[model samples]
Target: MMRIAIVGAGIVGLAAAHALLDKGHQVTLVDPGNNQQRPTDGNAGWIAHMDVMPLASPKAWRNLPRWMMDPLGPLTIRPAYLPALTPWLLRFVLASSPARIKSSIAALRAINAEALPSWKALLTTLSLNGHLREKGILSVWRDRNHFLRAEDIITRQKNFGIPLEVLQPEDLKQIEPALHSVEAAVLYPEGCHVSDPALLAADLLRLALERGAVLVSAKALAVEPANDAVHIRTDGAVKDVTADRVLISSGVWSRALAKQLGDNIPLDTERGYNATYAKGAFGLNRPVMFEGEGFVASNLDTGDRVGGAVEFAGTQAPPNHERTSAMITRLKRFLPHLDENQPAKRWMGFRPSIPDSLPVIGQADKDKRIVYAFGHGHYGLTQAAITSRLITEMMEGKPGSLDLTPFSAQRF
Candidate 1:
């Protein structure tokens, strides 16, 4: 059995550790404890399999000015970080080209199609199937103009065989009475939701531990691949470790570590903000996406967690909680009865994003001993299981079922 070391304890890393252990590998997880700012802790928790479109689409590029003009709009970039962000933005523009978006959609769909089934299998293996709620999610648009503008993409998604239902005004009211009058609502019946993503992540880590995988609390500083083993340097009680192989799944932080290993991946951070309120705060049945708002509100068993937005800020920048406040303020228009008085927990997390929206998931330096599997962006929660399966397949020297060309570490 191979001795594998995984960096980052987020959903991707933890799921990978569990998969590696089940394959009889000795696994060690290196993470810097669980911080609220970690993406795994504060994502929208929707297994959005139909989210195959890349964020850098032609439409998104056209709406850039309007989105930027509105400081609290769906997408924003800090003025101070604009210089550092220009390169990524330029690449994003390139990726928005028709050809690139088509390829990106193909790549995303390959893994996304397996998302729900993969999660089901993983949860079943862990005897935690109940953790996954297959309740459908809604994408609602209040303005007829917005819905009309979105028709092209909606039609494209339907053409791709994604099960989608266009609900009428009266139909939406009967389905989700909590939502105020909406012009149109599209239902994705295949989407799944997890009541508490953090709790589920803890359970996955616990299972890995029970299976003899070791958890090292530390921040990985560097990754050095030698002839025999890969060396991992970190800051914690355990300073360093050497393993037969290493998988870098540390989200946005993976960029530096990958660069250290001769891969200049253009991985940047999409600083996302979120707020969790007491149960029954807005009383929704399932996750609801505000069609044009670039955010979603989900009714979790624990409470109502509303969040989403892409802020092009570097990882080190302090979060602006004002973004979360803005979402709540806008959401109040839809759910006028939304109780802001309820106790709420606010959070901001960095989502590791690539220009094309496809994750980097393959061997690094043409070496099977070193692999890279970060950059799932906002869909990390949805694709984590499938990614783990592919990672395990690669580590086992078996040909992966899906083509790795699109997700290759060398793609960039």
Candidate 2:
């Protein structure tokens, strides 16, 4: 069996490690201090096969101003950093072209369909429940004009065979009896959700331990590319570990390490803020999203979770707790009965974003014994399993189930 090292213990790394083990490789998973929470824990927890478009869409561009202004806005690029953020933003607009968007959505759909089954299979093997349910995702539109605007994209989704369904108010109520208010909602029956991402991550790690994967609680200090293997350096006086291959899945911090391997990926972190309210305050039988604000609200048996926004700032910037509260407040606006003042929990996690809103998932330079599997942007949770499976196939010197060209490391 080949010996391999995986950096980052987030969902991506964990999934990669598990796949490597299945391929009969001895895997060592590494990570930093876990000083910060991972986005895999706070995301909307969707595995959406129907919502196939990248975040770099024309609709997103049109709403950029509203998405940037209010500190509570969904997509925020700090005003002071506009000059610095222009290139990434510009490339994003360019990728929003009709041709590229279609190709991207096609790739996304293939990857997601390949991923969904793996998630269920793995979760079943681990005997862990993240409260995953495949009742699908419903996108509700409060404004008729917005609904009409979204119809064109809905057509695209239908063309892709995305299992689309437009529900009127009565149909919406029947499908989601607990729903408080809705003008219209479109359900993607092929979608799924994990009620709690934190628990899922922790449980997956536990299962990895049972499968003989070691988790050393120290940060990776450095990695030296050797002729036949890669040597990993850790904190304190711990001896360096050597492996036949190294995979970096360190999320937003991955770019720094990636630079060591000769890649100049334009990776920037997009902080996603979330508010988790105590049990039964808000009502939702299925997930509900406000496409305009990038806000999502769902009912967990224990509580309610409202996640929203994309703040292009680093850990250096203090989290805007008020911004997280805004997600809850915004949800209240959608459902008037939802009490805005209810005691809620707030948190923020960074999602590493690339210019094209696509993850980098391939090998690095030949001189460097490393492969990249980071920069998943808003869809990391949605795409992790297939990514791991793909990386594993490549590591085994076999072809991956699908083409990896679109997700190449040098796409930037």
Q: Name the best candidate (by TM-score).
A: 1
Q: Give candidate 1 misplaced runs (Cα > 4 Å).
A: none
Where does candidate 2 stray beyond 4 Å?
A: 177-181, 236-239, 366-368
lDDT of 2 at 2: 88
The superposed Cα distance between candidate 2 and the true structure at residue 17, in angstroms, equals: 1.3
lDDT of the candidates, in the order given = 0.88, 0.78
Clashing pairs in 1: none
**Candidate 2 per-residue C-alpha lDDT over 17-104 given as tens digits, one digit per residue, 9 for 90 to 100:** 8888887788887765455557877777777656666887777876787666676778776767677778777887788898888778
Q: What TM value does model 1 have?
A: 0.97
Models 1 onward score TM values of: 0.97, 0.94
Per-residue lDDT of 270-292 in model 1, one digit per residue for the tens? 99988999888887888999977
Tell me how many residue pairs clash in candidate 2.
0
